[model samples]
Target: MSLEVLLDTNTCIFILNHRPPQVAERFAEHPIGSIGVSSITAAELSFGMHKSGSEKNLERLKHFLTPLAVLPFDDEAARVYGRVRAELQARGTPIGPLDTLIGAHALALGATLVTNNTREFKRISGLALEDWL
Candidate 1:
């Protein structure tokens, strides 16, 4: 599947919880295989699962991930990360480390990042964004 949209952690959580409904509605508007999450996003979700220690939530996460591709943070993404981090640091508007990685992943893959945290993500120049919420 050629992923066109990379779901951020918060967007995934909103979908999982079915809040506001529009996020899931917009998600459904897209074709399958065109949407996915970065491995960094999966890690963030995993952290939440571990912290909550809820088997039900874990199972839900597993089920949520079953159909979507979890794109890995590869060498290309690392290269993008370096550039992104440097640019953000230079601008004196550095976001969180994980967010930088996530943005870099989306930038590397040329996928539009679907996120609720646009204020933070918008700091990365040339990174496409869509706030489903």
Candidate 2:
């Protein structure tokens, strides 16, 4: 509960009802702390929930993200995104677009990314990430 975090999209879904997620406790850290989400994740979650047609699940998601500090997908984030993407690619390690963008947002907020995909994220230099698992 000591570290404030920005959740990766997968982890955010767990916030709704996945009790066994190792990082669920991290969300409690931010009852007052801002839980940052990438715009891509917001969209992905909305799409999944929409397709699932679970009003209860959708409500839970809204409540989960409606509060807390948000890092909007903006021009500044785009600049960082390009820089990070190029840097990673130059190193011959390519990550998914969503992950690259999420890492950028996490860096923008100076918060550690809470994710289980540590191996992929660790490749980016200077980008701080944590394994919720």
Using lDDT as the measure, the top candidate is 1
lDDT of each: 0.96, 0.76
Residue 5, candidate 1: how far off, in angstroms? 0.4
| Per-candidate clashes, comma-separated | 0, 0
Q: How does candidate 1 fare on TM-score? A: 0.98
TM-score of 2: 0.85
Per-prediction TM-score: 0.98, 0.85
Query: What is the C-alpha local distance difference test score of candidate 1?
Result: 0.96
Structure candidate 1, residue pairs in collision: none
Model 2 misplaced regions, further than 4 Å: 1-3
How many clashes show up in model 2?
Answer: 0
Q: Could you tell me which 10 consecutive residues in candidate 1 have the lowest summed lDDT? A: 23-32
Q: Compare the candidates by TM-score and give the number of the best one.
A: 1
